[model samples]
Target: MNLRQLEILAAVVRTHSTIAAAQDLGMSQPAVSNSIKSAEASLGFLLFERVNNRLIPTPEAQVLLADAEHLFLMRDAVMQTASYLKAGRKGSIRVAATAELSESLMPQLISRFLQNHLGVDVSLETHRLDTVLNYVETGVSDIGFAMEPYPRPTLDQTPLATLDMVCAFSAKSELGRLQFVTPVDIDQMPMLKAGSGSRINKLIEEAFQKSRVAFNPSVDVRFMNVASYCVEQGVGVAIIDELTASCRPHTAMRTLPFRPRVQITLAAVSSNSRPQQRLVKSLVKYAREEISQRLRQVSKERSLKGT
Candidate 1:
């Protein structure tokens, strides 16, 4: 029997009344009755015995119910999957990000994204800044998050925020007592800087040069979390973006605005050679809004603290 006949058969067997099954199936009682007759004729067997206006399933019909239940389950799954796909909720997004952002920003953003897109899965990879850009450029990753990635002809960049540089140090450090830390304040202090050649590092160098202070750093680290940890240990004062400082709020670490007001762009990088998938587009939009909201919260907190 066809699926329609099988549906009516199961409904009739379940409700034990054509009128009730018809109401459940949104069909007239006669139409349900005709469907049952057609199914019984096609099967060359009696599927139900009618007695006293009640339908009882035969032994053969009971066996078919078991298999029909499976079929109905599969049908429901297919329909739900189709609906999720059509609504841009079913898909996997691959992201490659620099270690700094992968640790600090992407986790919160991905958690928020997952809460909304229940059927979506995320794959996050942490790499160096250059490798992150390469992953997006070569299409190995759908998107990459980085701080001010260099302009590339093969990639698209979505600016999320322009974050100011902040000085991270132990709360007990003398520098923490100041309203703002400058290159001059940390000129001779042990300084923890990011790896050489990074965009933020370049900006930091420029700021120091403009201030005519030595840009020498006592240590070089690859990730902001590590730098924050060192600062918490009272190793040195590190200059990091506001995003990372805000995210890694170690109780022993305090951040002060670093002057001469060095700023860097936090951006989402993707391949420009091909169209982004709908899921990727939605994620980018969500990331933008989430970052903006977080920045506002940070600002409000800073304001309340008179910072």
Candidate 2:
């Protein structure tokens, strides 16, 4: 029988009279009686016996009532889950991010999100910027974090933060005394470079060109973390995004703002074909706040240090 019929059956069985059942269910007595008759017809059996102006449930009615109760419980659970999903408190969110962000930012963001949303499941994938965009474009990831100039025309991209590029150097180096590093300061010094064809490398080259200096590198690396590590080891000074350079407590590596302030724009990328999931949008908002707060904190600390 249908859920409404089963509900009427349950009400009648509980109240022991159609008149009482009708009052409990906000229906007329005849309406309750008709619903019981319909249920019984659908079940091909009598559900109740009328005697002494009272209703007594039959064996068949008891069995059906048990099943109906369980069905109602399951329906309640489904509704609760739907409410949770709608509120962005439950569901799975798949994210793909560039190596720099995945290592430096995603861990804290994902952890805080999980703490706030206990029922949500998060899957994180780390790759290069190109792969992160590909994952979002192909529907393999619900959201992606990568640096701009985002080349993917198939995905919607929102700029999240623009982090300045910083010159990273060993704490013991002579350049560490400077509050900022100008393109002229590092012109003659050996430098570690980002990948030759990377957007960051092009930006670095343009910065040097604007200063009327030649761009040169002692070592070439594909990742910002690698460049930072090389700077820490006194291999050479490198310009890398502030987020990647300042994420950890580094005693050996110190970062200074680069003069003329080369910047890397971080963006949230999502597929055009799929609607943005509630949890994914929540994550994007969380990430933006987290990064902004972090940058402000860093700026405050540097000001206090008189650097």
Where's the lowest-lDDT run of ten residues in candidate 2? Answer: 72-81
Error of 1 at 78 (Å): 24
**Runs of candidate 1 exceeding 4 Å displacement:** 1-89
lDDT of each: 0.84, 0.84
Model 2, span 1-307: residue lDDT tens:
7888888998999999999999999999999999988877877889999889889999989988876655665465466556658887647777898778887899989987887888787878888887777667766678999876457668888899998998988888888778899889988788898766888788888999998988888798878888887887889899899888878887898888998778888889998888998888889999998899889988998898788
Model 1, span 113-148: residue lDDT tens: 888888786878898888788778766677998888
Clashing pairs in 1: none
How far residue 137's Cα lies from its native spot in candidate 1, in Å, is 1.2
